[model samples]
Target: MDNNKRKLTEKELKRKNDFEKISSEMQQKGYKIKNMTINIQQANFLGPLSMLPFITLTFLFYHNVNGFDLGEISLGFVVAAILFIPLAILHELIHGVTWGFFAKNHFHSIEFGFIWSSFSPYCTCSEPLEKWQYLLGTAMPTLVLGGGTAVVSVMTNQLLLFILAEYMILSGGGDFLIILKSMLYRTDKQESVYCDHPYECGFVVFEK
Candidate 1:
């Protein structure tokens, strides 16, 4: 989408300024700053592609441990499928709730809305936070909603819950993408922090 060529509006400029102000303050406080750009197009495309392994694993687990029957699809299955919509929203809420605590503005610093271009919802924090804080917030939805659901599915042997859990995990492709990037590009510095890019789909990291 040629993110570098994209022009910033006044509001975006203000957001950038505010984000940078926080970064500058951190730098002055002896933290080194690094920025990461997330390409929405790439993220959107890769998020689903990255789910291949998870989907395969889920299928294998169901087939080997608990036989999966296609005939199981019924009215209940339809109802469970409908829950995806709310779960999508819940995914973003998880991000906000986890990250908000670390932000100076608390819940106020968290923004939730949809990205029309990608047709995806997002939850972003306006404040800078420690690297671990950002990681925890980013991973919470997958760990709790996705992983937790999977455990329940395994225990109860509910195919619907298993499918839902796998879907949730697959849907978290973008979060994992960011986490992977953070880890790959991480610095050896002892102190590090990360914040969302004011106008982009990804985050910026500060390390020292």
Candidate 2:
């Protein structure tokens, strides 16, 4: 830890304690912490791996639903691809906005920054939340931006929008991966709260 780093709040401290306890139990059960860290290499690999199925399904579904022709790449596709920068920012904003609502300090508890080495933008909530609230926040961008845009693309027969939506969904692979890990190892405890890791792309669970 850096000496100049901001001190954790009392709430954050308690959450950290709980997280450490859960981590100890998990380690005893053979879980490795390294497996949960979301670094640049993992993102590079998982992004495309997760996107293959998403792109294929979106293409097929839109084709079947609207009878839309899969057309050749055009200038419009290029434009949409360029728009991914703003879209990525919006995706992080969505996470901040949704998760901020559940935090005790609201937006003050939310931090948005980029990992320059990974070229990834992230929004993290410092406060702890119930498992369901955390899940909802994690899934909101995928559900709203990804799935919603894909639905609209199907309705409007826009290939570019479909591709864009698939890309957004793919960007969420890290979130889904963390959720999957939690589900696999989490105990059935009602007091469990999920806290987004301050310096990483995953979450830590704390149970009272």
Candidate 3:
């Protein structure tokens, strides 16, 4: 039942095989690995909103013109600050696209949130992905979304844009951290088949 549409390198295939073996062995050895439900909606909204503070901070503290500032204290940086919202949204979109492409009909939901005081986005898939797929899906948003924003900001010489991009890259959190943690634990970096959890088989998380 494997979809062979995407080609995996030998090293990647080996890692996936090893992870499956470990998960199977662990289960037979009496270790429990349970799947958990993830709330994607929460991630979608919160992820974009997380950039609000940076925008607000710029307007409040850096604006040069004021009066009807919509509670904003500054306007000098308005040109660059507004991009944060869209940039955050793009972050989620990248996660969605990556998950959607790999998992086909396995999409569950999307969440946006200030999770643990950090902004992030994520998607729920039907099953755990291969380790390489999981890693790529999680990192795609940061590189494509955050990195793209940063690159464009630099090319355009927009300071506010740069700030927003940098903030999203730094504070956005989700499956990226899970991937890092999984690596450290020497466990399957990707969720095993039929698993569910925040970092389970069917989902990829992204930061704002």
TM-scores for the candidates: 0.85, 0.76, 0.48
In TM-score terms, which candidate is top? 1
Q: Name the candidate, 2 or 3, with the larger lDDT value.
A: 2
Q: What is the C-alpha RMSD of each candidate to the true structure, in Å?
A: 2.8, 6.2, 12.3
Candidate 2 displacement at residue 175 in angstroms: 1.5
Error of 1 at 10 (Å): 7.1
Candidate 2 lDDT over 38-138, as tens digits, reads 56467678756766777688778987887644353464467667886788899999999999998888998787777555576778787767778888898
Q: Which candidate should be chosen as best, given lDDT against the real structure?
A: 1
* Residue 65 local lDDT, model 1: 78
Cα lDDT for residue 152, candidate 3: 76
Model 3 agreement with the true structure over 1-208: per-residue lDDT tens digits: 1326446545336445644664666577555554332345554455446545544654343333322333222442464366655666676677667766676354543333333333433343334555566567667876765566666755665555555555666445444454544454444434343322333223222111
Q: What range of 10 consecutive residues in model 3 has the weakest lDDT sum?
A: 199-208
Candidate with more favorable, higher TM-score: 2 or 3: 2
